[model samples]
Target: MSTPWTPTEFEQRLRAAGNERYHHRHPFNVRMHDGLLSPEELRVWIANRFYYQRNIPAKDALIVAKLDTRELRRAWIRRIHDHDGHDGDEGGIERWLRLGEAAGLERSALESGEGVLAGVRLAVDGYVNFVRLATPLEAVASSLTEVFAPDLMERRTAAFEEHYGWIDREGLRYFQVRPPQGRRDSREALDLVRRWATTRADQDRVLAALDFKFDVLWSLLDVVEHACAQK
Candidate 1:
């Protein structure tokens, strides 16, 4: 049998995968962060991205079901609440809607999926389906993208604040709050994957799952970039 990797080695491999393939380096995101996108391009992006945002709770729900332990379930279920909200909490979906509003998108259109591109829907749905079919370890490992997300969120928030002043400041709440939340969530998922993915095959699967997530994210932007370029 192939030797299993130590947690440190495995983690390094995962981070390397992200560094190489994550959407942060995508031309669309690079343009966004550089404050070079036209308002129409940014609006198209925001609208399509909401398709991914709204599906997060659904994706997390699938992962939660695959989790075996009540403790794991309890911890993972919070992700659903974070996006879907409970009681009076506004939740991430609502926060994203507010972002759409600030960008001048009609709430009805955003809610109705009028702005969601075909490719974005396919990619987001594919992610949810992958989580449903994945082993718990792989499903959780796919979320290691969150390990990179806190910094991305911080930079995105700064980019918007510095470059896109027309967007209502209040609508930036999702970017502001997501950094710490991503850190906490990624820590839990990393611990689980490190503990559960003990075999070489399991580690390989974990890495593959993370790469699949990168493809999903990158493909979404690919579609958006093409669509925006046509406009």
Candidate 2:
């Protein structure tokens, strides 16, 4: 018979899965963070990634709706605000739009989502749907990709400044802002998962959820890289 998993083993497995499959290792991210992507490649990334930036709030809201406690709801709601902004004049989505504009994409094209690749749209939608349908604990685990985000964001910001001279600081605002925000959010989320996952079964589910999330992130980058390779 197969051996049952323990909480410690589950946690180790989760970390291993992230090490194996996180977007940090993806070719698209590697190229972008290493200052190797062309201006046209940067434009493609900004255009495709706009879909993900826009969907994050919706994903956060879905997770919020699944939570039973007001404290959890309140804590989670900040993510929506961080992405959507107050009065539509600030926040991550706006910063991403500025990046798109710097890449020469029209505002209409971004808002309409017409320029986004089909695979990118599917991957983003799959993530939101996974959060919507998953258990609250599983939903939180799915956000663990944020744990790796700070490093990726820092590298991306540095790469843009050093190699992509066409994109000024104003255009790379989203990358500059994401590291601290991602660290805070991911820490809170990891704490919640670690604290609440007391049972072996719960830990296994959390790990699986994290693995699924990594696949979602990896799939998005794979599609982007495939397209870039074709160009």
Candidate 3:
């Protein structure tokens, strides 16, 4: 049986999960950052990624439903607002639509999720379903992927500015805003898991949740690449 890990060891293992499996290592994302994708390929990826972006708040809502404490709910609800926006404020979803336009995709089609691949849709839905069925701890733990996200977001924004110069600068706002936001969010999630997942089994479950999210992101990229290949 696996022995309970020290708090520091457990945290290291969690970070290792992202180091090994985060989608920044996915071939499509590597190509994106390398500036190798055609405009069509970029559009394909953006259209599909918009699905994942919009679903974040949905999955977050599922997590919110599982939380009983007003404190937990109050804190968790910010993720939803971060994506969906408060009144008079635009959010990540709108920022993503701007990216779609920058990529030369029709705003209406991107907003409606038209041209999103079959596999991409399934992958995003699986994430929402996973959170719905998971324990509150597991649901929150899955979001620990944010611990690894800021680097990718930063790299992507820089790549856009340097390599894909044709895209409107305004569309880069989503990527620009994400790094600091991701860092803040990841600290909250990592703290939650570090405090709550004290037992071996609980820590294992948290690790599994992070791994599951990694696969979801990888699957989305795989489908995006495949869809682009067929065109």
TM-score of each: 0.98, 0.92, 0.97
Ranking 1 against 2 by lDDT, winner: 1
Residue 108 in model 2: shift from native, Å? Answer: 1.5
Candidate 3 ranges with C-alpha deviation above 4 Å: none
lDDT of 1 by residue, 1-231 (tens): 999999999999999998899899999999999899888999899999999998999889989888888998999999999999889888999999999999999999999999688999999999999999988888898899999989888989999999999999999999998998899999999899999998999999999999999999999999999999888
Sequence-dependent TM-score of model 2: 0.92
Worst 10 residues of 2 by lDDT: 1-10
Point to the candidate with the largest lDDT.
Answer: 1
Q: State the local distance difference test value for candidate 3.
A: 0.90
- Tell me which of candidates 1 and 3 scores higher on lDDT: 1
Q: Rank the candidates by TM-score, best first.
A: 1, 3, 2
> For residues 1-231, what per-residue lDDT tens digits would candidate 3 score against the true structure?
778999999989888878989998999999999999888888888888899999999999999999888998998899898899889769889889988888788999988878888999999999999999999889999999999999999999989898998899998999998888899889988888888897899999999998899999999998888878888
Q: How large is the C-alpha RMSD of every model relative to the true structure? A: 0.8, 2.3, 1.0
- TM-score leader: 1
Please give the ranking of all candidate structures by lDDT, highest first, separated by commas.
1, 3, 2
